[model samples]
Target: MKQTRTVRQSIVVSAVLLSVLFFLPLAVIEPFRAELFGRETPVEESEPEVGKLDGEVMLQVLNGDMVEEMNLGTYLMGVVRSEMPASFEEEALKAQAVAARTYTLYKIETGGNHGDTADICTDSTCCQAWISEQSARENWGDQADTYAEKIETAVRDTDGQVILYDGAPILAVFHSSSAGLTRASGQVWLNDLPYLQAVDSPEPEDAIPNYYSRAEFSAEEFKSRVMQAYPEADLTGEISTWIQNPVTDEAGSVETVTIGGITMKGSQVRTILGLRSACFEWETEGNTLIFYVTGYGHGVGLSQYGANEMAKEGADWLEIVTHYYTGVTVGPYTPAALQAP
Candidate 1:
């Protein structure tokens, strides 16, 4: 593919246009916690910082009910181990480490919504996923040593480095896979960010055990489910007409889907139906309503599988992240403040 084959410049990065073009009137299924109907921010671009940092940072991380004081280095090890598969390419893993670091700092600066208990949380549903070295070892079994070294190297190689937009840490959100293209943050959330725009995420279409999946619902069951979320929806007529016009965005994912006289975001429908991704198509087969979904996760930021493909094709970590994150710069950063004391 053009994205993987391009000779990426080392220091600067630009979004790959092909990745942002239409893939499907596509979608996300991300581990995001932001409010969908909240206030939106205007999209803006800024110059990212370019420099190096000298010392490690510290953080107070929420691990269940307890908050533990941890160093950036230690926390990132657990995160890379838990969040990404150990078998991914080394450059891909390194990109994940940097993204995790930038996200941590972003959370800290934003006064994370975890009350006042910690700087960040370990819950993958709300924040990033993390696992201790011991648990990682037991899980990896015989390959434990090899995986441990790889994870450590991924973290160490990118220490203090981050992807920045406008001289601060970018949100740095990422997801597992995309439907040939990633989403712009504005399309999925309340804000449109220049660094988080839609881009080509050309990972292998059949790259996994569940890249494509199906969910089937009988007409009665479907009506019941839709009514549960929207009691006002009129799903009484022909099942086919119930899911009316779907308008797609520039990214190729549906922007709005009119279901049973009620219009909602494709993401809202995806949540109600428990689909793998927001990029989906629905069909009626007699009494059954079947949804065909493509990709996994929110389809924003870096596509983990896409990055791995780039790395496999010899693209470095910098190229991997920059391609997915629009126009961003990679550099070392010293936190405005470490984690909350």
Candidate 2:
């Protein structure tokens, strides 16, 4: 069979373009102080001094009770080295960095951070989990880790204080996907009718699991999601009832809400979980809820999947981030004030 060579050729060309156009140029930027070869470049003396944490920065850092740092160089390199087009533009990369930074600050200040939140696996019921691609691990792992470390170190040096709710450091997780399918953070005073919004909604297109949109949910898809959830149920009408009302073995209260005039039985007493949103759709295939979920993980903050997609399409980090978070800025922080009080 003749494999289509178009995509292969395009990828090769992109790789060549990146090395030649971007990576090769870094050696010439005097202010950056990066080495062309294996040589070390001293941090520039004229580089802006790290600043003291102010009310805004401290609030931003502590509000969510979490903080993260990414070395701009490493972060930029990851986006620059991808199959992005020459037209991807440096400005877009800068924009993405700003948006991501702004969003991070927003979450920290508003939701009080998410420290000690169980890993997606243990907390499966609370949030979803998706695997990073093997290529991402091999190709981008070290760079991404370095970027994260840079950000962390910067924050620490800046004496940035993280706000803790109930004495917890809060939680900070990174991603390349869309904001969740709900409103898990932030606030608005609308005509004095202030209320927290649901923090859930459609998973951003970019955050689909490893480009897993290759599969669509049909009757067959429904069967697969159901089987994954309930292994032994026969796909029959009797089972449909069970699927409709997934009762746990542990005794719990029962309450009902009418959806489209249909009263559905579920756990009584309403509850609000983090970043309210629903991605998986389970249909009744005889007796199982045939779940057809789109995207993966909590649909909040940066969408790593979307980032990957944009990177593939030659978008820089800035472009990817701005597309998700509506309005924000990417600024620098310093270690002046966050010293131990």
Candidate 3:
């Protein structure tokens, strides 16, 4: 009986010792195992919030003395129709849509220059040119349906796409035509933009409407206009001497003209004389100042005629945009992060 009890006790002690031996190593190795093979902390994933402007935008459109609210896409269609000829290539129209959209977004984010109470104005001189769809259709006449379809397709094709510079929407200014080349932003607006650099636009000069325009003014008329703007001018000189030292850019835009002893920028002269473009050459022929002008706009940024020409050459909308806007990327639109104080 004593032997049996001793054997039983020994068996219980061995079992406990074995159990401890097994569990001791496991306990010691568990902590080191985590270090040897990194245990990643479980990260809880939250759902991504939807982006702003979810394919819809609000626009404050100017209608005479009243401001009207319109859908962004609808507004863009009207802008495209009014801004570019409906007869332009589809790719050109698409390019215009993206440009207009980018411009609109930029204006919205940066607080448009029009007014604090209004998002944008219909006045082409103040903001972008906008026209009603009914007016655009009237302009199209027999081709209204076809042209409207094309414009709608272009706008739909490039939906939600914008030209981005450093991840922000570009100003995306466009003009009717260029003087064989696009103007740098600095040359026109005095604000240098990387994407608005001078680029060779292979648009056929003949293809552009009113590519070469001559605006002739009598010497008296020229002097009268100049004097009206710059009242303090010494016009006591030869007619040839009245206009002196005309500085021109590589694109042939007049940078400055010494008129009535006042050095005025080409833009100033263009505005003063109601000229189509700043790219002009003037010479005194008898009592008349014959001004030979080329192109038909401020000559900065994209050229609508040039874009159409590119489209004719098999370049897509993206290619056309990148070509006009140097070093720019066409991508999905994203609202810029607000800068902290």
Candidate 4:
């Protein structure tokens, strides 16, 4: 059971997002349909025969120019395969399935953002990454059947289960990994969601690929990058004094950093420098600014590697989901409105 949070705790900051949860697990993306750059595309709404089953929830997934509709089970399988490694513990895969399903429902409830063309999209930037069976097979190679079974079993076991907060679907966002701790939703986004709070995420560094990386930019290159984003940044100085006064959260994610005399969020700096995550240390080597980054994606909600580790430690799917997501319940949900008439 979750402890009753104090009034002060309810208004804490949140950490936003990334493509960290899906696809490569190394990239970053926001939940729902909001995306970096201009990921939303205008596509022709095609007339489709949405063959409705008795109680099955259907999904319209925009793949490039085409919108493919499939039952929730099939879509969850593809999403799980694309979002997480099939070789992970079955429990971890199950958790991912539940998270994906909950996110899908939340999107539909919030109204389709991809115009009238799709309820969601294959673009990881826009929504979540989805791979077709053929594509998944090609990627899995000889182990395709085994991998497919693992993912399918995960979806089957979870069935129509979703993680709900107060009887409504919670925004089940996830990330690849974190710097030992997960971030709250407000630290990364505008809203500090009650379920998306910072928590203990015990993902070891070495186990996660690209968990630690270094980026070196010449003083001139760094100035150019900073100038393009923040023209007010005072880059005219000793390169060593360029970045100062970094305010960090309990999760060790930089909340704000004074860069070149301009105050900016750590996430903004991550984007300006193409850093893997906001957890970073910097130094000046000669005329180059070197940043040593730790972890991947925005540090919020479920940590994919952390979930896998928890599963490895014998936590079930529900336990894993509820642990990272804070207050939530796992159960079946097919609204009367969505059922076949």
Candidate 5:
């Protein structure tokens, strides 16, 4: 009787200890695990990973110009984490794993290596001619590495291939302030390059050629601008030509202008344009001469600031992507899954 009682007591103690150990982690860890992961806490129900996409779909994505100018690698990591449930669903986790594996192979085979830096000119001067000059600088700032990591992860996750043309990475350029829906801007640079030396301020002489409307607007506005400043002058030929020509030997009249709380100076007309004064107008979309411009480029794909905003707002990767790119599903690209197996 004594031996049996001792054995029973030992068994009961072991069971209680095991239970305590098991519940300890759930009590201590699960609640705050998401904080460590840099993601929202997983809901009680399991979230499933999307099934693999077809090869045709992957091929189409590669062939077609459907790409976001972001850090592919970082994007992939977010996708993987977002689609997965912390508790792990076998099928969903398996699919994500397979997709990740396949994407790695695809990147290696496609020569979409993300090492070499093509000539990226990010200096205010280099891309200052851009319509969304401020935005361009922000995108290409010190956060390039973070963006690059996201892009690399995305390519790896999607099994997406990058098409190299002429031994160079085909640039799917992203820029702010594209005039109209067209990507054309007063400023552009090789998509891969960064680092530019500012030669001059945002003025006509320093302004890069307008790739979209050419000098059409400038030509029309230049003469009127000069005449408005100096009414008693023998202005001949075209005022546009004078605006295009540099006023060497001496500085033109200087004036102060403020944009977004930052102050700058230029000739009276130049300052007005720099400040985006209503010196000129464009009659488009209901004939309302819109003056206060906010964003700089075609508001499509991913807005860099918008994405960062989402990130800061504690939105996970899936939410960030869906907010910008509508009518698209987040899924992995796999060969066997695509094939009739």
Candidate 6:
């Protein structure tokens, strides 16, 4: 009986000790485990970086002989507002923004025409036209807010974007309209840029205001203008013999003509006569010389009216730019890459 009781007591003591050993370590490790788990709080995610103009661009605005420095985005808004009609489609406005940006960067990289002090000038006859938001609003009048918002949206949507050719910014020249086609760079300018070659621009003639224009000058006025530029010309003959052997391009723009025995390019004549474009048909109506002209501007690159028509046809900005520019890429604009060596 005594042995049985002693064995039972020993088993009971072993059971108590085993339970104590198991519970003691858990008690000791509870605080550390809690601390380890507490240190593992959920990590917060960071927000994405928004696209913005890398740096400010200096603009030598010819407003009251004042130079205005502005961010590239702001400058683009002003340029788009001034260059393209704000009533244009959104995609067309976007395309204009990219072209304007690319042109500005190209000028900046090429040392522009403003010497070393100014990056660009605001004169439309020289560089691209630019108008302040205030000026644009005033010009827009009752449509001010709507037009301003449209231009701002275009600039913001195309922020930091530029047109690139061969990994460099291209000379993105644009015009108001074309004579059913854009002129090749060689035809209009001195050198022919490969990307600026002639392209068909099929848009509604009625889309552009004053697509066709007529200018009549008296024989004496014509002779005076022509002789003023070329004083050595022989103008003692009849009007029919005075202008002869006119050669025209594919788009019907006068390539060259003999005026009083002096051959002059159509561009020179356009400049001399203050005609709308080089594409003109002239006839001697009695003593008055009448010129029927089509299109407006130099017609070397993108046509703004054509762009609007394309946009109306559901083409995006990228599509419109690539279509007009030819074999160029649209890429992000980096100020560092545009710096002059």
Report the candidate with higher TM-score, 4 versus 6: 4
Displacement of residue 157 (Cα, Å) in model 3 is 0.8
The weakest ten consecutive residues by lDDT in model 5 span 194-203
Clashing pairs in 6: none
True-vs-predicted CA distance for residue 184, candidate 5, Å: 18
**Regions of candidate 1 where Cα sits further than 4 Å from its true position:** 1-55, 249-252, 339-341
Tens-digit lDDT track for model 5 on 1-341?
99999999999999999999999988898778878667885569422222233223321112112333222232333333433321222222223333333333344344433323311111223211111223333554775445433433343444433222333222222222212221111112223122111111112211213322311234335445545655554445533223222221121212233322233333233333443221222222231222232233322233333444344456554554434333334443333322333
Lowest lDDT block of 10, candidate 6: 46-55
Candidate 3 matches the true fold with a TM-score of: 0.80
Better of 5 and 6 by TM-score: 6
**Number of the predicted model whose TM-score against the real structure is largest:** 4
lDDT of 3 by residue, 195-296 (tens): 999888876788788888999988778888988999998787678788889899888899888988899889889999989999999888887889999999
lDDT of 6: 0.83
Cα lDDT tens digits, model 1, 108-218, are 878786867888889998889999888999999999989988988888778788889988889999988888888888777778999998888766876665988899999
Q: Report the number of backbone clashes for model 1.
A: 11
Query: What ranges in model 2 sit over 4 Å off?
Result: 1-277, 333-336, 339-341
Candidate 6 per-residue lDDT over residues 1-341, each given as its tens digit: 99999999999999999999999998997778848666554589532221356233445444337776555676777689899999999999999999998998888888788775577767777778988888888899999989988888888788778899998889999998888888888876689898897888865788688899999998899999999999988887777678889998888988789999999888889999999888888998888889999999888789999999999999999999999998899998665743323
| lDDT by residue for model 4 (89-112), tens | 999999998899898888877885
Model 2 accuracy (lDDT, Cα): 0.35
Where does candidate 4 have its weakest 10-residue lDDT segment? Answer: 46-55
Tens digits of per-residue lDDT for model 2 on 81-126? 3322223234333333343333334343344234433111111132
- The residue ranges of model 4 lying beyond 4 angstroms of the native Cα positions read 1-55
Better of 1 and 3 by lDDT: 3
Which whole-number lDDT from 0 to 100 does residue 336 have in model 1?
55
Model 6 stretches with alpha carbons more than 4 Å out: 1-51, 54-64, 337-341
Overall lDDT per candidate, in order of appearance:
0.82, 0.35, 0.83, 0.83, 0.33, 0.83
Better of 1 and 2 by lDDT: 1
Of the pair 1 and 5, which is ahead by TM-score? 1
